[model samples]
Target: MNPRFTNKRVLLTGGASGIGRATAERFAAEGARLAIGDIDVTGANAVAAELGGVAFAYDARDPAAAPQLVEQAVAALGGIDILLNVAGIMTWGRFEETSPESWQRTLEINLSGPFYLTQAAIPHLKQCKGNIVSVASAGGMHPVYGTSAYGISKAGVIAMTQSASLEFARFGVRVNAVAPGGVATPMHEKSTAGRGVDPAIFAEAAGRNMPKLTDRQACTPEEVAAAIAYLASNEARFATGTVLVLDGGQVTG
Candidate 1:
C-alpha cells in the first residue's frame, strides 16, 4: 500500500481519545511520525506507544503552554509538518442557563486554544511548508438551539481559518477546517448524556430537520479523520481558507 503521509511529522492535540485519537491512528497507519499532546498524560502516552511516537502533556487552552507543545513536538519529531488542533470542550445549554464561566471556557477551549497552538506552530510549519487542519463544527454554520457558546466558538474557528489561510498562503502553508456534525465520539456522547433528551425523540427531530440528507445517523470518528487527513495531505496543496462541512449534508438541501 502506498502511504500518502509517509515520513511526515504530525503534531496533534487532543490525541488522548475520540476524534483526535482516531486521527492519530489514521496518520500513524499512513506512516507519519506523530507527536501527540493532550491533558491526559497516560492516555496520550498510550496512543503514542501504539503509534511509535512521542507524547506531551499539554493544555491546549494555555497560551504559554502552546509554544512549549510545538517546541517539544519539533524536538521529538525533528520538525513539524502537519498540525491538527482537535482539543475542544462542548457545553450544551440555553443562553439563559449559560453562565459567564461556561461561555468563556467554551470559547477558550474551542477557539482560543487552536488560535494559540496554530500561532505557536506556524514557525515550524512554515519551515516545512506544512498545513493545519482544525476540527470545527456544523453548529458554527447553522444556529442550533441551546448551543450558543459552542456555535459561536466554532464560528470563530472558521473565521480564523480564513484569515490564517490568507496570511499563510504566500508562504506555502495551507490552513483549512472541518466542520463535523453529530459525530459518534466521546465528546458527542458526553454532550447528550443526562440532558433530559429522549434518544428517540431527538433522533426523530434531527431526522426531520435533515430530510434531504440520509437519516439521522451520527458519523464515525474515522470518517471525520479521513476528512482531516485529506486537508492535511499533499492532495490539498492548493486548498486553503476553506471550511469543509461534514454534517451529513445538513447544511445543504
Candidate 2:
C-alpha cells in the first residue's frame, strides 16, 4: 500500500490511447497528480475524470502550441515533475511508396512533437528535477522493410533521448525511451494505408522484431506502460540517455 508517486505531479501526452492511456492509469494508481492531454479531447477528458485529473486538447505536432499546452498541464497538475511523451503514429509503407507529406507528418507527430513539448516543459521540469520517458519503437533499432518513416522517427526519438539526457542531466532531469516491438494497440491496427500491407510481410516484420521467446507476438500496452513507469521512477535515478528495449529479445539478435 506504499505509493511510489505520492504527491508527484505528471503531465502526460497522448493520455487517451494505447501506451499513453495505460501510463496515465498507472501513474494515477501510484498517487500522482495527473493532467492528460491528447488531440482527442473527449477521450482525454474521460480518462482525466476517471483519475480525478484534468484534460487538455493538445496537438503536439504544432510546435507553437507546446508552450500553451505545458502551461495548461502545469496549471492542472499544480506543478510538473514528470513529462511523459507517449503520443506517436505509425506510417506503414515502403519508402518509395510513401509520400513526402506522410513522412513529414509521421516525424512531426512522433519526433518533433516530443521535442517541442520537452522544450516548453524543461523550465518546469527543471524546477522539480523531473524526468521524461518517450515511447519509441523496436522498428527504430531494427528497421522493418515497409516502415521507413516510422522507423526513422523512432530512431530520432532514441537519439533525442540520449542527447537530451546528456544536456539535461546537469540540471537533474532524466531523459529515456521505451522501445516496444509491435505492441497490440489501435495504432498497430492502422498499420495499413492503401493497398494494405501484406500479411506475410507484417508477419515477417513481427518475426524479425520479436524473438523466439515471444513466439512472434505483440505485447500489451500495459506491459509497455510498466517499463515507462519504472523509467520515470526513482528506481532509475542513475539511468539516463538510455533506450529500454522491450522488444522481446529481437534487438538481442
Candidate 3:
C-alpha cells in the first residue's frame, strides 16, 4: 500500500459487504479514516469496528438521507476527502419480464442513490479538492440479456460520472466510475442461482460474451477495490470522468 490515502476521510455507501466491504478494508489498510453507511447495521458496525471507523445504518434510496450521510461522515471523520458510491441493487430479468416496481427499486438504489449522495458530497469534496468514485458495471457498456434494470441503472451512473466530472472540474472535484464484470461476489452468486440454468452453463455463456482482453476467470472484489483506490488517490489527479473496467479482458478483448 502506498499510504496515499493516509489521514484522508473517505465516505462509502454499501460498505457492509461484497465489493463495498472489500473497498472499505482496502482504504482502511491504506490509512484512510472511513465512515461507512449501509442498511445492514450489524454488518456495517462489524466492519467499522474492525477498521476503527464509524458505521451508519442508512438506506441510500431516500434522497433526504444523502445529506444526512454526508453530515454524519463529516462529523465523524472531520471532513470528506473521497466519496465512493458503492451502494446499488440488481434485478435479473428480461426487459419485458421486469415489473415496474422492480425497475423503480433498481433505479432508486443504483442511479438515484448515487445522484443524491454525490450532490450532497460535492461541496465538501470541492473544499478538499477530493474525488468521487462510483461503481458501475460492464452491463452499462454492453447489453446483458437478463440485466435490463441493472444495465440501465449502471449506464445512468456512467453518464452521471461524466456530467459531474465536467461540472465539478472548476471546483477541483474529480469524478470517475468503475465498471466491473463477473466479479465473484455473493451478489453475483445469488443472481445466478436457481435461475433454471446450470451454474457452469451460465458461467460459460458469460465467459463467451466477454471481450478477448478480459480474463476467463471472474474478477475479485479486492481487484476492483484496488482500481477504485487508485482513482481516488492523488496518483490520478489528472484523471477524471473515466470509467475503468475490471472484467478480466472481457471489454478489451
Steric clashes per prediction: 0, 0, 9
Question: Which residue pairs does candidate 3 place in steric collision?
Answer: 211-250, 212-253, 213-249, 213-253, 214-248, 214-249, 214-250, 215-248, 215-249
* Candidate 2 Cα lDDT to native: 0.86
| Candidate 1 worst ten-residue window by lDDT | 203-212
Candidate 3 residue-wise lDDT, 36-107, digit = tens: 999998999999999999999889778899999999999998899999999887677667877899899999
Q: What is the TM-score of candidate 2?
A: 0.93
Measured with C-alpha atoms, the lDDT of residue 158 in candidate 3 is 98
Q: How close is every model to the real structure, measured as TM-score?
A: 0.93, 0.93, 0.93
Better candidate by TM-score, 1 or 3: 3
Model 3 bad stretches (over 4 Å): 194-208, 211-215
lDDT of 1 by residue, 1-253 (tens): 5788999999999998999999999999999999998999899999999889999998866788899999999889899999999988877667787789989889988999899999999989899899999999888988566678888999999999999999999899999999988788877786546355445434543533242456665788999999999999988888999888888777765
Residues 199-222, model 2: lDDT tens digits: 655665653444546474667899
Judge candidate 1 at residue 180 and give its lDDT.
Answer: 88
- The superposed Cα distance between candidate 3 and the true structure at residue 252, in angstroms, equals 2.2
Q: Which candidate is the best by lDDT?
A: 3
Which pairs clash in the backbone of model 2? none
- Model 3 alpha-carbon miss at residue 166, Å: 0.4
Quickly count the clashes in candidate 1: 0
Off by over 4 Å in 2: 192-207
